[model samples]
Target chain A: MKIKQISIFLQNKKGRLYDVCAVLGKNNINIRALNVAETEAFGVLRIVVNKPDEAVKALGEANFVANITDVVAVEVPDRPGGLAEILKVLADEDVNVEYMYGFVEKATDEALMVFRFDNPDKATEILKKHNIKIASEKEIKEL
Target chain B: MIWNEKFECMPAGELKQLQGERLKKLLPYIYNNCKAYKDKLDKAGIKPDAIRSIDDIKKLPFTTKVDMRDNYPYGLFCTDQKNVVEIHVSSGTTGNPTLVGYTRDDIKLWSEVMARSIACAGAEPSDTIQIAYGYGLFTGGLGFHYGALEMGLRIIPVSAGQTSRQLKIMQDFAPKILGCTPSYALYMAEEAREMGIDPKKGNWKIGIFGAEPWSEQMRTEIEQTWNMLATDVYGLSEIIGPGVAQECPNKIGLHIYSDVFYPEIINPNTGEPVKEGEDGELVITTLTKQAIPFIRYRTRDIVSINHEKCKCGRTSPRISKIRGRTDDMIIVRGINVFPSQIEHVLLGIEGTEPYYQIVVDRQKHQLDEVEVLVEVNSKMFSDEVKQLEHLRAKIKKEIESVLSIGVKVTLVEPKTIERSMGKAKRVIDKRQM
Candidate 1:
């Protein structure tokens, strides 16, 4: 299943992240899972949100560079080596994962991982063939 | 220790007469030989006979770097290519480079002036000189080379860089004169200390520094570091290189060889001659150049000329150290860099906004470092760090290729670079000198 994630461009300046959070909170958009990719000059703030489209619109209106990216979400067992086993499958099949972050599903108390893959459709199909439970956009918003 | 006392010590009234005679011949020579000068003069409605003396030089139209670029390769040469013995090209603002040609006699003139410049720095005929100015089209290294040859001084034509070897040669040969850019002279001093050598203990006696502007504070630093008399030498390729004017041991204003290359200072905005000892744009005319002669060429360098007698007894008019430039051009490590050139490179690259800023800084005991800041737009921004880094590298590569110097490319937030009245301010030079 494909998930929509909102990515905000953050310059390495004071109060940039606080400004992003303030804008999101004012718009009543809830962030589900977040990860920051940082370099010396700037950072990319990527978050899975309850309302991806509305969050991106608010960020754009606030003069922040924001866009929606398609990512694959998979459910993992609440155990050690869960992420490693899933990663091994992708590595064996030569499917590249750009980046990944983890969050816990409150309903089933299961671990869920968000992955940005080079080819999201191929990654989704491979995980489906392997009988792994794929989390959908509905599951993201329900959280 | 004046090199040629006959010309260097000539009385002021006599020098002006010789300058007038040279200018009298130069006007008609360029008028008939070079079409660019002829067209410029014809457009100004001034005939060759209108210039009876050097005093009438104010009547001539001013030539600029843009004019030289428009003429390109050989369009400005007064003599035939067969008589041209050498050529040098300096970087222009954009597109075409400024070209200069030297005839055999012009090369001799360069040598004589350079010899005088070296001697003005207090060099004796028996002393050795280590020339570290770059050679080739730059016109710095060979300019000093010819001068050293003319003076019959032992020369170590090291020709810039190779820091450890430069220190080794300085230790081995013990040259009396060190010729290079002032910044490089300081850089060498630092390198020598790093190699466990005392720069002050070296056998260097005189430092002939030019090709870039330096402050008197820098002069004190260099002199103390090397235990040598550091003097300033000034020149541009358009008029003969590196031997136009030089500061004598007296540390007064640099004495201009106005006998051959007549100097004038004018208001940059009004084009009217400024009063004596007042700062303005420097205008030079090639009075005796055979291959390429210029009439009242606007050098864009700001300075003031002193006509009073120097304590050294050289009657040549002395010009104050260069204060600034009339244009948006800067010299970084002896290379001319215009902001327009950087802007041109940025505009050519897709996804980059036309707005940018150049930051030049010089740390103590180091050469200059340039950092170019380009604002990141939504279209160029990416969620991946690698993609953003790739874009920065691309901008860095394109700019370095255009400027021929390495620079650091920094990506900033949109609107981070300050703006005043809706236009982004371009350059921020933080170097103290």
Candidate 2:
């Protein structure tokens, strides 16, 4: 299953991250998982949030260049070999992961990992064939 | 399209003779009429009567901005105060401002030259021009205003600012010619898009952009932005407003009306003339100016000149687009660096906004440090960090290679750098000493 992720462009300026957070907070957008990819001059802020379209619209209104990107959220068994098991399944099927970040669900025993894949559709098919549980947009928001 | 065939197409020999005659007459007139020129010529031990031809113009002394400042308002005017019809004052920024007084005849001459400048930019009598240059003491607005009236073009006279109103007028009146500074033209385009109008689809077929030094790369950017034939118009208040020279459709260089305003390029420090096609400071002499005639006035604008005839068949000597101003050239570690040079390189590179600011600082014992801040916009931004880093590194490497100095390139957010409705300020030097 695919989930919508909000990606924002931020220049490496003072308090820019705080400004982005403030915009999201003012709009009552709940962030499920977030990570920043940073460089010397600028940073790309990626967040899995409730109401991705509304978050993007709010950021755009504040003069932020933001857009929605499709990313797969795979459910991992809450065990020592949970990530490795899913990695092996995708590795055997030759599905490449561009980037990934994980977070443990508050009430569930499973961990949720957000992944950007080279070919998302192919990766989604591989996870389905291996009987690995995948999270949907609604599941990501409910987390 | 050729405004005045007799003067514009005069043969080289005849033009030289005309310039020599005008120069011979101008020297005596200024020396006799104005006390400033009298003292300068007497101090240089040159007799005004002995200077017979334009060749002897070198023997005369150069009039610096200090001369204008020392004279202040109305001291260097060659005519009586009663004869002066209007006056324009330039922003001094440092000391006393320089004043230029225009007699009725001088205004007529300005109108004639500006009419030639407008026509040189491929404007016709039927075409309408929306002049965005500021009016009042600034010469740009009224210069184009007087010229368009002379050329019989429908005038909009929307003198600068009011971005939304300017766009609305462009749509409603459908003026074919737009006259303003190049930076303001770009700003207008940005504002036009924000107002839900297509900039390139506008009806501004010709743009006469001047009042500041701009690079050829900037010309291309403006041309692509508005889909207009962007031409450079060159002039100053001291010389005679915005009609000193103009670029023809050939786009090689701006044709200086040498018969009326004689031009010579000289080394800024040595005052010696440079060879043809060599970049140096431009010095102009108002050969026919009545109110305030300048004899070899040092313009301080760096440019090269071409004496050869242009493809447009104008025999007037053409000057290259201003490379930089002597006043604007910042020396970092004994190396000359121009903001325009960095702009030229930046415009050549993809994924860069034209807005940039150069900051220079010096410590007590350390070498001069230079940093260029460029704006990052939506078109230049990416969703990956590595791509943006690559962009920053590319900018630094390209600027360093072009300037031959180590420069720190800082990518700033869009609109961080100050925008201007007139001349865009591009430098910030913080060194105390």
Question: Against the true structure, whose lDDT is highest?
Answer: 1
Candidate that scores best on TM-score: 1
TM-score of the candidate numbered 2?
0.60
lDDT of predicted model 2: 0.84
Each model's C-alpha lDDT? Answer: 0.90, 0.84
Candidate 2 chain B: 10-residue stretch with minimal lDDT: B89-98
In model 1, the clashing pairs are none
What TM-score results for chain B in every one of the models?
0.97, 0.77
Q: Score the docking of each candidate (DockQ).
A: 0.58, 0.27
DockQ, 0 to 1 scale, candidate 1 = 0.58
Predicted candidate 1 versus true structure: per-residue lDDT over A1-143, tens digit per residue: 79998888787889999999999999999988889999887898999889988998898888788878899878877789877888888899999999998764443666888899989999999999888788889988897
Q: What is the TM-score of each candidate against the true structure?
A: 0.93, 0.60
Candidate 2 docking class? acceptable
